[model samples]
Target: MSDFSAEETDLMDKHEHILSRRAELLERMEAGRQPPTSHRKQQEKEAEAARHRNESLLQDLQKIEERLKGRRLPAPSLLAMETRYWASLEESIPAWEHFLLGKGPHPADSRGRSPPQRAERRASTAQDRGLPPLPKHRPAR
Candidate 1:
């Protein structure tokens, strides 16, 4: 009987030890199977988005650099042409004023028909712009 009792005690101890080891193994497996933490997942997503944005910005910068590299500087002839255009404008101002005001003697008196024709064309154009007709004159007060 004592031997049988000892055998039963040993079996119970073995059973308990096995259950404890199984519990430890299951705990480790469950821990290993868990997904990444929410914070870590969010950080990874943000990092990926930032990388894409940075790549797009880099591409845009490269395109701008290429455009700058290929750009041509204006030639000296453009400066000369611009200067002539401004001088012509200064020389023609009296005619423009005469056409718009309609009071000054025809600009043709000094420069000839070209000024009057230009003025007449401008006057007609002004009439077509939906603006009020040019006043005839304010009689000298």
Candidate 2:
């Protein structure tokens, strides 16, 4: 019984020594390893910076969209008004052409004479006053 007790005590001491040595080695390895907070803090800071950058980019995009909207194509009301004005001008084109061709009523000839007769009388009076006769057709350059 004494021998068995002595052997058990020796084995227990050896086990305790080995456990203490392993604990020391583990502590040294832990000390040599990088600190947990350094890498984590660096990553957290980078994420925060990225978040700020993304927020600024989003704001810039919103501003650009607003500017583009302001500078976009003409509004429907403006286009409609322009279309109405052009239509009015189109409706008046025939009157303008008649006036230019001397086919419209003359203010001085309010007796309601025919346009050709009025033009002929004016041309004859002008010729009688010694003016050169007007060309029947324009000569090509």
What C-alpha lDDT values do all the predictions have? 0.88, 0.87
Error of 2 at 45 (Å): 2.0
The TM-scores of all predictions, comma-separated, are 0.37, 0.34
* RMSD each, Å: 17.8, 21.5
Q: Look at candidate 2 and give me any clashing residue pairs.
A: none
Worst 10 residues of 2 by lDDT: 105-114
lDDT of 2 by residue, 53-118 (tens): 999999999999999989968999999999999999998777777767988754334456777898
Best by lDDT: 1
